[model samples]
Target: VGAGGETAHLAYNSGASTQHSPLEDENDYEESDAGSAIGQLVNGTNVLAIHGLNAGATSSDFHIEPQLIITTRTGGGGQTGYFATATPGAPNGRPETLRLPQTVTFSRSPGPFTGSFQLSITGAAAGQQIRYVMASPGGPFNADVPAPTLTSTLYTGPVTVNSSRLIRAAVFNPSNGQGGEPSTAQYLLLETGSGNNTSSFTSPLPIAVIDQHGGGGYGPGEPYKTSFLHFFNRGPGDIARLNAIPDVFTRISHKVRGSSSAHFPKRAYGMKTRNDQGENKKFELGGLAKANNWVWYNPWKYDDAYVRNAFMFQLSRDMGHWASRNQPAEMFLNVNGGKLDSNDYWGIYVLTEKIESGKDRLDIESIGSSDIAGDNLTGGYILKIDRADEDETAWQTPTAQAGSEDRIVVVEPEQEDEKPEQIAYIKNYIAGFETAVLADRAGNWATRNYQKYIDVPSWIDVHMLNSFALNPDSFRLSSYFHKDRNQKLKAGPIWDFDRGLNADVDSGAQYDPRQWNGTHFDMSWWKQVWRDPEFIQGWVDRWWELRGGALSDANLNQIITTMGD
Candidate 1:
């Protein structure tokens, strides 16, 4: 096929059959086919299509290029000429080409330094000039935007950089007023001979630099403040790449978040990525799933190892269940909204995915306001058993015993988004499950079997993980349950285990591994299921299966070693 939709046919035989063929003598073949005569040229848009039949085998390679030849008939002879480059199966080319200005380059790469140094900028062509801007770390400059309007200084000679700051530079054409994209580099100054003081920011993990634009310190309640977030890390196996450029930078609404951990010195934060207009924007940060909502988990003082929560989540995912994905990161929080320095370093934190209803998260169906009946009303709900917050809306199971104040709170379908019928459906579903559990314990397994209402494997896995970790808060606080449309209730994607693994130093009883951890707190559904012999056997069988595999001594040691390194 020619570039202008002209077609021709060339005969060849593929080496597929063992039968004798006319072209069998030749091992390599190349043939030229002349396209059909060209028609009068037109000025408007045109398209061409190329078609072929089994061009080659799966392991073979094939490519084709088509060209259009124009002929001018003179008085005596015809003159053949080639036009512009052939664009087979593509649109015609424009008369002129557009080019961007050259990018600006820095003499020194971003990194930590001990003293002031002379920095030079280059990479601008003769017709282009270099413009630059300097600001404190996590300042107002953003290099990702094109043709940003800023108070920039013209580059003439080397400049002295004495402190930690960010530098952004770009090339611009003076005649056309066109500017190329900008380049950014960060410089961090450190004290010489300092050990522990400087080592905090030089971590092997990724660094999260947050700037609140000189806002007040974050509070533990409503009204999240607008902030800027920048994440830096070179990638896997690149240990301590403190000079690496940021892999992610975006606007976020940041606020202090936690139930009991909110009072800690190093507070955890809940953030949602947003755009310049303050609308929700999803980002794939730290290699986790893309979601707007995220959490920066602050390990409690008892968890000196700082791997309790991460380990638990990893183990849960290894057991074929979905859990909140997280990555270890060091944070530099500029709440006062000035230059980021050693004092702004907030130490280690886990950048975690928030539990919600999404394909990458819980992988459940979403229920809309109109879906208040039939199979739609039966599912895609996330419920928690944590302490109720003021102004929170939740419902209590009808089968609750006297003095039992455990109210199930809906985590998804925000209270305002949930309909009355949908709430009633999930509420009654839990009540029925509770009633069946009590009835099944009384030898009514034939009909009122509790297993029929819940996913047995998921329940067993959740039970074994919490029990093995000796999490005192299991089955009560921060406990989660989720159900999908037309699917039975399932437990898990466990959360908030900083006090787990015998790390609760304040209480001796809770720290003891031998004691049943769930018993330390008020019993809920698991309490009733323990009386069922079937459930007991299932739990015991699952324990042995995991002990021989994922929970084996050698496997556990390997996992711990890998995480520590």
Candidate 2:
């Protein structure tokens, strides 16, 4: 068989070619311009071999699909041929093999012994084909054997296999040769006695643990500590289990996230999947696309309804902007070795894309080298109007901007390593713009407008989003501004909005759109620019124009409904 699955008959130097099979070359599969492997038919058999190829160690576990075979030809005069497999075996089979559940944990209720109770089902699909396999590890039962193995109970309905302390039950997909991870090694005594009927069976969202044993617990201002995080999602074949799902080797640090909601019970974390040491491994959580670094956002303010941030982010994208991508997740902490202590329910959170300079993320230049100069030093910078933590190195504006107390922080480029000239360049550029804004004369105001320093349309869109959503801390804090070297400063990729969408503000009743002016919050320079009659009219004109399109009620309503689903 050639790399493209075309069979070629090559003259064998001897009489009958040795009978070969695809499985023989399975591990040795190699890629060419033609595909992965190439082979030729030998005497009565197909043998596959790569020319001068080194079959190095591969992590691939190729599960051949199940197939039925019928003899195409029978022995005749000097001829005996059988039908050969036409295609490479499919891994896990046609619909894909099912995987054993990653976690199975049983907890018995302490209520009065009742021989009657329901073992509830949550994740099970209504009509999906599923079966239960109960096995005792290191005992008389094994999952590797054929069905009806001794001491193992294979049932089509909900199981009551708690008789043996070590009986592990997993959802089995016989057709796909996959089974979920067996439940933990212990049995739950639902009732105090052997004859008591099994009561409740609840499938809680799988627990995830971020063990920061080296650094104790995470804090608002803490150094990055080496951490191991493991979270499970139901897949591989419809079974969910612990540790059997995704795993991430990360360096985690808890930097306070959100504006006012930073004080909420749940804290946001900044996780670096690839730290200074360059650990590039990544995992997909909640079935979201894969990425190395992530922000585990706890939307504490929104409580169980954690869609605010995801909603806001989707709105930004629909309005033709690049915003953080988010997925709702059930976050838990510190469950190691089947023990859940010092753990937290942590509740629902928005697992979001961490704002950074990367292809999938901010998509800006990454000027990380210490010796960076010229265009390299100009940007790929992620500057923000966020409150500076103690560890953050920042530059204070020479003249205080009105209404805002916090300083702008240079979030990217690790300030300590930034060249003095590079640091001075951005500082002076911002300062020069501020000076020009403050010194704008009536006639020259348009030419010297803050518009020259920023992407006016983006700023307008961001303002409209904040205004429409009535977010209290919109322009001032948790606000992000970035530029890519030669590009003008663009507003947002918007952040934290748990406080948006009619959420109450702790300071006051500031959710009213009329009361909250985008200009009045912070960046006093905005107030000076707002005074210019031309800029004000442009802001209003641009806003109303967008209201007819992206911000239109119909468009927004559709976006809300689609995203909610």
Candidate 3:
């Protein structure tokens, strides 16, 4: 050892040694010096010196081999033995064979059926037995949790399922006392009209069936309830067609989401996929990239076409901006803990991706808690001007007048995770931008120019889209601004266009495209920037550029047709 040493003596011809032949003359030795010898092993390097006398052989025949053993136990009641290989003098082999039981397979796949069917589960070896558990219609069944021994039934023969239910089965080997991972299947009885009009309803879009356990409706606050989501569409290659078998079936925690839209009869939901232990699980849904957070947006009375939000987001992406990617889906919600029927049909909804910090989303650099100086502290933030929510973390901008609706809410990093330093940094940045905009209007461009703080092309694009659509909520609400590390502030990946595109007939001013939509509200930073001739010329130039391509009649018509279909 580097700093300490241990000593052990081997008796030459001790009668106490248990040996039979000349080659079997061996003695076992144990080191008892724990304080100095064990603690002497250093991290990087160590020197081990051996001093011994060869009593039976000459110096040329003297040889020795040492074997070390270490054992550790994991938190999950599992243990790992020695890390070294077995040698001629010392053996270090596993005590028992570790093998997983074979997976249980069902005779029929999970899907919708018209009548009762004979279900057979078959996947057991000689020492293994099958165990299964059944959940009533709309009941909870988590495949991540092992089947309970007291409640699980042993599979002895064929089981018949007549009504809708969920089944989970696993192969258990009593000899090894180990159970294989469980397999789950959902069966919906389509013949039972059960008030849910599943027999006659047909949809061109994918179908989403959500079954909430325990029957009480969703709430707007904390503590989302457990639920199951089954998505049905034509398997992989032919996604446009409808199929009896579901493409995605997993557990989720869901709750009512949105501000004013939460009161609508057709409810919107904030959902996240969860594993058996109720941890965040990511999955790709409807050809979209993998994500854990999702939104089921319900188009209410204001948007009769049910495509305003989707269309606007698509157009924003077409203009080279990253908006929320959404897919049309027909949803069926059952909160009664019974067989689903026509009453459960909740109509069409848009499954939209939630905006946040991800490579597939805003693509901003992540800021850690310790990144308080230099370029690391400069940016990668997402802020929005939205209605005040008691549960959200927001700051009042210095440029905002008292009682004004400019409560800047932090979107990325979330409310609970955002630090006070991050909030202060973003607030100071926005205040600087406002000061520069005002100074530019006052003809003081020598020091702080508005163009130095913001991405002018992004601002112009947002203005053109809002002005062209005559969106009443243009700059006032749901206005998003993001900045990446070492980058200028950029406006929008536009959101909440359900009231835009002349969707609200009562607001007649919104129907006219010539009307300045941003002026309907306080306008905030836009009002000061509009006063600059350079900004005005840039806006005009961008408008003409868009008209020649994205906003052209032919292009707009094609987009409308595609959305309509």
Give lDDT per model, in order: 0.71, 0.54, 0.71
Task: Give model 3 RMSD, 1 decimal.
Answer: 10.2
Quote the RMSD, in angstroms, for model 2.
16.5
Residue range 1-565, candidate 2, lDDT tens digits: 2333222443322122232244665354433342222333344545345322112235244333322223435455332222112245642232223343333333432111223333322232333233334333223322122232113454444445333222334444445444444332222223333342223211234334454332335555555544445454555454443423233323333344544455666777766554323346565665656677788888654534677777778788878888888766555453122222223345656678878777767888877656356776668677777677765667668776523577777777766666677677778768876776776744556565666777777776777777677776676777788888877878787887776787755655664566655443244446566666676777799778878887778988987798765
Each model's total of backbone clashes: 0, 14, 7
**True-structure lDDT of candidate 2:** 0.54
Residues 68-110 of candidate 1: C-alpha lDDT, one tens digit per residue: 3445466675323332244678864443112243667789866
In terms of TM-score, how similar is model 3 to the real structure?
Answer: 0.75
Indicate the residue-level lDDT of 165 in model 1: 60
- Provide the global lDDT of candidate 1 against the true structure: 0.71
Cα miss at 517, model 2 (Å)?
Answer: 6.8
Q: Which residue window of length 10 is worst by lDDT in model 3?
A: 13-22
Tell me how far the alpha carbon of residue 159 in candidate 3 is from the true structure, in angstroms, after superposition: 3.2
User: Could you arrange the candidates by TM-score from highest to lowest?
Assistant: 3, 1, 2
- State the RMSD for candidate 1: 14.4
Residue 240 in candidate 1 has what lDDT? 47
**Positional deviation of residue 527's Cα in model 1 after best superposition, in angstroms:** 1.4
